[model samples]
Target: MLIVILPDDSRREFDDGVSAYDVAAGISGGLARAAIAAEVDGELRDLHAPLVVAEANGTSGKTAGTSPAARSAGAREVNVRVITKKDPEALGIMRHSAAHVMAQAVMRLHQGVGLAFGPTTATGFYYDFQLDKPLSEEDFPAIEAEMAKIVAADERFERMIVPRAKAVEMCRELGQKLKVEHIETGLAGEETLSFYRQGEFLDLCRGKHIPSTGHIGKAFKLLSVAGAYWKGDASRDQLQRLYATAYFDKKELTDYLTQLEEAKRRDHRVLGKQLELFTISQTVGSGLILWLPKGAVIRQTLEDYLKVELRRRGYDAVYTPNIGKIELYQISGHFPYYSDSQFPPIDLSEREGQKPGEGERYLLKPMNCPHHIMIYKSKPRSYRDLPVRLAEFGTVYRFEQSGELNGMTRVRGFCQDDAHIFCTEEQVADEFRGCLEMTQTVLKSLGMNNYRVRLGFRDPNGDKYVGKPEVWDRAEASLKAVCESMNLPDMSVEAGEAAFYGPKADFVVTDCIGREWQLGTVQLDYNLPSKERFGLEYTGADNAPHQPVMIHRAPLGSMERFVGVLIEHFAGAFPLWLAPEQARVLTVSEKSEEYGREVEQKLKEAGFRVTGDYRGSKLGAKIREAQLGLIPYMLVVGEKDAAEGTVTVRDRLEGDIGAMPLAEAMAKLQAEVAAKTVRQVADGGAPPPPIDRGPKNEY
Candidate 1:
């Protein structure tokens, strides 16, 4: 007999080799029916996998206060936790199964199809298939229909583990050359491989799949199709990537589809064009954004707002050139390391006006940190001058692949609200806290209240990092200490997401529509100031040279991307202060045209963005045009109001208000602007007044 340690610390006796499914059946019939997989020693595994122990122990009763590993490591026990349909891991298993079902459906519908890998993504799953022809949206319905048939048949998924050689032979026998090549290149190190078979379809995968196809239900959808190179290599064969998503229930799928439609409606590219806020011209470039007057106002307002806070925080502004010597990046380890993502270096040595070897090569600045590092090393400093804070709205460039570029979110050229601080090791925690506070302040000021903090730590087993393990530990501990002191909520730790230099903190903000965007970040680096690199050092109290710790932070990561998210978040209906045109004066007739001009001039002189519409069109047409343009307020100047020294107010969302004195109207609008009131007009309700608050975010 073998002792099985359940999650609740209860002990159960089972014969050797008893499967997880059998254990679930022993617990309850409902759980056995609902069980999709199980957790074995904290690793997810198929339910059909056998659970066994080396020997039987006489141990009985609950094991209290002991770790799960300690109990499972006993001579005669194995830990088993049955996973039901409600488990989070179950969704990932089902999505992987759905990808297999999709691949099978495509094979059944077409001939001579070669299947590569079909993997699950954060949102859903996609399969890359080497097909005879390209597939489009028109073909999705037929594929989904076939997938439905397969799901209805409820075919059981059979897992077969085989040696590496046999797996290659199986792929060859199935005429899947892509799989054979993958096994040869990507899976060559594995001694054995796992393959799953359902009906006439089989694929090589190490999977924790659902028991059968029927568990997928009818919530699966084939969303789109795009061309992808095999292994993401442009030199490899071009394959068709069928993007898809799935859920356990129809309502969940329906809700997801609704969100997708809403996201489409909120797409910044379409709205950018419709609202005339920004443009991407083919003549200029694909990824470069041309911020129109309206968009410029929004960007400028954000900069001014942050600049005020920065000044209060005692940060000094600095400027850097757009290009620098290639050797600078080489010294910073960004030259060859990130060369693929950077534009080709400018070889000035061959310029017509330059002699041989007179000019060295240059590169477009990929990051602002290296330049700031040089700035920090420019002058001698002592312990008293430590914690030097420098900030800039520095523009950087990257060579993003054309396919990956999407509007302002993923662009080649963009400006970063970048800042760097150099401080002593003892002051690392304090400076980091200030950065965290600043980031949260920015998010809260913009009314982005729904956000979570993520601490990115280095992977213990990974060697991609450049800092010493001890230094990395210190830096990570400092950041954690600050976060704990501040008592940040909804925080999570993600390993292997840290920068090459050091660990970092990221703020992932969720918009009103439930889409999360990464907007702010603070990174702690111990690698850049090392003696092997820039040899940056400041005099300590003992008069010895000591390397200072560097903190890299950007509250607004990218101005263009932040504006893009803001555009979608508010649907282009900006707040009073951020609006390009705060108020537009519309004339009731030609008689009031002169008065409308006066009203526009008065608001403009009072430091408001105001415009006058003295068109010959009717008043209704003018109001409708302003409303479509997303103007916040419309001051109606009719002959009656002009004579009374008043104006009728028309709000974009609240409709019309009674006439008020011109002075009173200006004061009301000014108050709203001064408060930076953010109205959620998308939901058709006015939000509460904006209060001046600090970084207290409520989930």
Candidate 2:
């Protein structure tokens, strides 16, 4: 007998070689029915796998010499759970089943459709198919209906392990060219391959599927179809990609669909057009954004505010050219590492008889770090200047795929609020802490309080990184120490995600609607070959030369992406301090026009972004216009208030706050502006005074 510990600190005794399914069955029929998968110790595995005594240090956590009943009573508690013996399967299994069902449905409805690959993604799953004709919305209903039929058949889903040669033969016989290709590449010397079958459909997969097809809940939807290259290589053959989603329960699936709809409504591209903020012209190249006047004002305000904060924190601003000789990047090691993403090199032969390398073969800047490094190496340094920080609002260009191009978030050309610090090993921790503090401050000021930290480290086996093992270890240790010392609320470590040059830490912010965006990043690099190639050195008290550590930090990742996120985060209602037009003065009629202008001039002189509406429109009409514009405050001037040297203030989401003296109103507005107030007042509304109408449609 063997003993198995259940989740609630209970233990059960069973015969030797008893599987997790058998344990679930011993507990209750309902539990066995509800079990989808089993977590054996810390690893996820098939529920049918036998549960043995786990060794002290084995990854599987299994051992022997214990009866089921005795082991159940003596088994230690662990974070493990069992799935249904023969009922619902795991989420991955469900998604994979759904993909098979969808593919089967596609085959039934369309002729000459060959399957490529279908795999579960982070959210759901997608299947690629090579078809003779392109798919459209018209075919979705037929495919869905066929899928429903397949689900209702309740066919048994059996898993079989076959030799790799036999699997290849089966695929070749079925004309599954893509499967053959995958098997040839993914399988090395392994003789066996896993395959799953449900009814007439058989797929090449490594799976732990549900007992039957009917176990798939009625919470599946075929979302859309698009074109994708085979194996994600653009040069390869094109395939039709069908996107879909599935969930264990119907309500959760419905909620996800609703959220997707809401996301479409809040898309920055749509809002940018509706709000007249920016434009992307076909005449101009893709990934290039043309900022309208209002958008330009907002960008300028964000830049100025950040610059002020940077200066206050001891950062010296600097400038770099938009283009530099190709040799600069070659020396910095960016050319070879980032070649695919960079634009083609520019030949300077037009100027004279200059070959590619003879004269400056100027290329557009891809990042500001290389130039900043040059600035650091321009002069010798000592311990006093150990933590020298240089900042720049540099614009960079990259060749982004056309399909990946969206609004400002994924533009080809964008400006980064970039900075680089040259510091010794001893100052790395303090410098990283300072960067974290600055990131927190920036997020708070922007009203982005919900965020988490992600520590990105290098993969030891990957050849992409440039530094030695010891250097990489020290860089990673510095980041980890800073995160721990700061006592961050929530943090996660991810390996094999570092930049080609070094390890990095990212500040990920989730907006109001639960969409996460990487807002800031700080990287530690000790392996830029340029430091050695250029003979960069710092002197110590021992009169010996040593290399300086490089730290690259960007608080606001890029101006374009930051503004795009800010737009959606606040839902277009910017805070008082950041609003392009903070206040607008509305006159009740021609009688108060002079007072309205006077109020606007006074607010403007006091450092407020104020505008006046003096086109002889009604007070209500002017107020409505301002409200639609998302202005934070609207000051009304009328006969009673103007005569008494007072103004009626109307808050944007809060109605009127009665009348106040002109000077007092100015002071209150100034204070709110300085404080960067984002919250509106309570919901006691006020009625706008009546006014005589003038010209129609006049502002």
Say which candidate scores most in TM-score. Answer: 1
**TM-score of each prediction:** 0.91, 0.83
TM-score of 2: 0.83
In order, candidate lDDTs are 0.86, 0.78
For residues 1-699, write the lDDT of model 1, one tens digit per residue.
557789998988877678899999999999999999999777787888776423337443234544566567653566889997797788778989999999999999899999977887767788889998789999999999999999999999899989989999999999999989988988778888999999998998888788899989999998999888887687889898898989887877777777777778788999998988899988998799999988898899999999998999999999999999999998888887889999998888776578865778889999999999999999999999989999999999999877677898889999999999999999888899999999988887778887888899999988778868998898898888888899886888989879888999999887767777888999999999999778899999999999999999999899999999988888888888888888999998999988888888889999999988998899999999999989999999999988999999999989998799999999999999887788755531222211111111100
Q: After superposition, which runs of candidate 2 have C-alpha atoms over 4 Å from their true positions? A: 1-32, 38-93, 132-142, 154-195, 206-215, 231-239, 347-363, 529-535, 680-699
Worst 10 residues of 2 by lDDT: 690-699
Q: Write the per-residue lDDT of candidate 2 for residues 173-280, one digit (tens) a residue.
A: 878888898789866666788887888888887766666667776789888898888766889888999988787778767776776665676677877887788899
Show where candidate 1 strays beyond 4 Å. Answer: 52-76, 347-361, 682-699
- Backbone clash tally (model 2): 19
